[model samples]
Target: MFRAIGNEELGRGTLGHSLHMLLAEDPDFPSSTRSAVDELMRQSELDCAVRAIIIAVTSAQNPHDELEHVLRSHPALLESEWMCDIRATLREFGCFSLY
Candidate 1:
């Protein structure tokens, strides 16, 4: 699941598709998983975070260094349990840290 989420090709849409598949096929998935998916499915909120992160990375002289800053700027993301899922996903993709 984390691997799929971290796939660069999938990007933000990864969580949405993953959630849909899980709900459709694995209705008995853990409560934590369902909660994370529900939060991520708030597309408007997620999009705001994604756009901020993208803009920050684009303008940053060191994009990696701006990751924490970008995330911090998005309060919804910072407060979300889905953020932990994202970090775990990125780590699986060989991204050492989101900070």
Candidate 2:
């Protein structure tokens, strides 16, 4: 299902959209399945901390809390160069308060 969602030929739109559809329709979906998908998403985002930071900052009402959650969840990213770049970008965008 993750592969299907990631496939460009499916015209399924974004993975998030496909996952939402599956979640809405699949009563038998297990928590483990959701966890696996989440892991895959997290791994995919690992290469782009800026994207993750932007998402964390922009998607939450409380960006500080959201960023803290992200840092806790991905501790390896704590001192990564990408994380530094993300902070600078956020600062330039006037979103450094999120940190």
TM-score of 1: 0.29
TM-score of each: 0.29, 0.39
Model 2 reaches what TM-score against the true structure? 0.39
User: Residue-wise lDDT of candidate 1 within 2-59, one digit each (tens)?
Assistant: 3234324333345634443444354343333334434544545464344334323333
Tens digit per residue, CA lDDT, model 2, 8-53: 3222355534454455454543333334434745776444443334
Superposed Cα deviation of residue 42, candidate 2 (Å):
6.1
Which parts of model 1 have CA positions greater than 4 angstroms off? Answer: 1-44, 51-64, 89-99
Error of 2 at 18 (Å): 16
Q: What does candidate 2 score in Cα RMSD to the true structure?
A: 8.0
